[model samples]
Target: MASVHWAIQPVLALFVASSVLLTGAVERSPPSFVVDLDKPAYERWNSVIDANPDLGRDAPEIFKILTGNINMSNDTWGILFLMAEKIHKRLPAPFKEELQGMADRAKMPISLITLINLAYDLTAHCTSVVSTDANGTIWHGRNLDYNATTYLEKYTVHVDFKRGGKVAYSGVTFAGFAGMLTAIKPHAFTFSSNERDVGSFLENLLEMMDPNSKFLMVLIREVLEEAKNFREAISKFSLARMPAAIYVILGGLSNNEGVVLTRNRTHVIHEFAINMQSDRWYVLQTNHDPWLGDPWYDNRREAGETAMNRTGRNNITVDSLYDVLSVPKTRNKYTVYSTVMSASHPEAIRTWIRNSTELIPPPPVRASASNVVGRFGTFAAVLIVLSRNL
Candidate 1:
């Protein structure tokens, strides 16, 4: 009986050891997708570009500059996939483990994971334009007229939160233009008068964010409440010197509604007509990515036309050039005008103007001198005139 128990004990010990080994060997689930950036895809892309020499030959200098700066590695794609995974909130466990492993290996602050993710995403999208030439030379579209000096001066702060502490990374280059500039000049555009003005504006704007900054808040509130009044003041001051139409244009009056009170009210008609010629005048947001066709473009045009027609200036013919300012900086924070024209046959300015339903009331009819005299006073004067004629 003792020998049999001893034999069973050895078997139990072996079973326990085997269980531990199996547990240790078990692999965590793979990330929804593993970005193997170290693979041959990078080389394939380069090879394709090297085989096509005629494609970017016209812009040799630009191509050289662009290719020199770009990092076309598997790491770039991996980072992009990670960002997309996070944004979609569908990151796989294995991917998460890899990210954790990377952070641990680098001894980086955990909070910085998100910032790194953002950097990766931005870089990936921006560098997508970079391609290789037939001779195996990499080219970047952004290198054309690349001003390295101007690129390095702008900086933005990034904050990361991990493990209940904040990690700050300053002077990080998330954009290619910025990276080029950083490599060139660390502090070239600082201390200028223009910089000072911009700094002051930013300071004031920042102060308004603090609840304790009562004075700043009051000033902001006043400015907001008096915006229309301020516009009117500027308009009146400028109108005193320049022609009414010019003043209206300079004083932030481009639409028919703004010019209705001015002497050259007809100017709005011309401006509207001119704006219609440019394909850019109409745009709208969409649920699908902008790379996909935007369904809202036509809808936005119809809406803008509807709004313009409501202003009641449809009939006026304008010969003079109308001042059509681009969408104001105050309105669009991310206004991007694409270099490529999307539509084949953009709507004509005249057609849009003709479609406007807004009608400016015709000028008041004038009464004849004889009719005025007969209707009102001056009967004695009329008789005197008749007697003198006789």
Candidate 2:
């Protein structure tokens, strides 16, 4: 008991100290790496894995919590890993290679790494906003809320994908996964992807298994790397087919560049854009179609819109935009990070690893059990692992 207490006290201190050191990390930024596009996808993140040996270290616990539709009642991780082996066959090639490299480099199991990557697709949620300030400068802000916020933030990474020694694009991504959840192409465009769960889990599973569909976040990564400008990205994004439905909020370099897309597996259903002349200069999206109201118990959309309007178009500075993101449900306990960026002001594209989870309303059942409960569960799980090793 004394040894266990000794082990836990330092572990707790390490957590607290890490948090203190990363204060305003979004401002200073997380460890940023340049990914070489010329290399095989799996080999690209080798350096990241080496620098952060903790890569895939949390997979066992994260996977236990994941407990996909096929494994909710199962305590054994072997079954989950086997189930994910099949899911692995269907994931895009780039991610397959990347996860392979990460698993090998981190000395973790590839199947467990695959399961961790799949966790986001199985269940994810976020809030994003694109606003055209009174001066007509476009500003994009997003709060990436997820189930395993506590663990996820620890591995956050900002990566710039480069080719021929020139930066092609960048995204603030989690270390193990290769997709771009929140990304930007300096002087070109910026965007964030949100998950859409409009149908049965079975239907979504079928979508994931479809060969013709792309993972939405990877598609974002593709466009950011390939698409030259906002117009090109808009066309490519709308036309690309995905395994499931999604929401994408985009901000371009121009004042007229802000737009929100509601997409199904094959294509976009609706497009909401900034209309400065019409006085609709800002659009806020929180895991719902713009035409439909938010689900009961979810006030992120209402709270975000209220904050945006209160801040108003004339005052859409990064600080104000962050304040809007900080408003109640918009920035909840589940949020891993908050990102604020503008393609026009490429240098100002900033991301912060967030720790506040205040005023989270009751969350529906999700792949990410509510962080309120899971945060402690995650810490306890880690402590147990450390104690055994010690």
Q: What is the lDDT of residue 75 in candidate 2?
A: 36
TM-score of 1: 0.16
lDDT of 2 at 189: 90
- Model 1 Cα lDDT, one tens digit per residue, 67-159: 223322343334433433442233233234433443333343222332343222112111001111223221111101111111211111111
Pairs of residues clashing in candidate 2: 26-351, 26-352, 42-97, 332-357, 333-357
- Write the residue-wise lDDT of candidate 2 on 98-167 in tens digits: 8778888888877777767766665668999999887778899998987766667777888988999987
Stretches of candidate 2 above 4 Å error? 1-28, 64-80, 86-93, 200-202, 357-390
Q: Give me the overall lDDT of model 1.
A: 0.21
Candidate topping lDDT = 2
Worst 10 residues of 2 by lDDT: 1-10
TM-score for each candidate, following the candidate numbering: 0.16, 0.80
Which regions of candidate 1 fall more than 4 Å away from where they truly are? Answer: 1-90, 123-390
RMSD of 1: 33.7
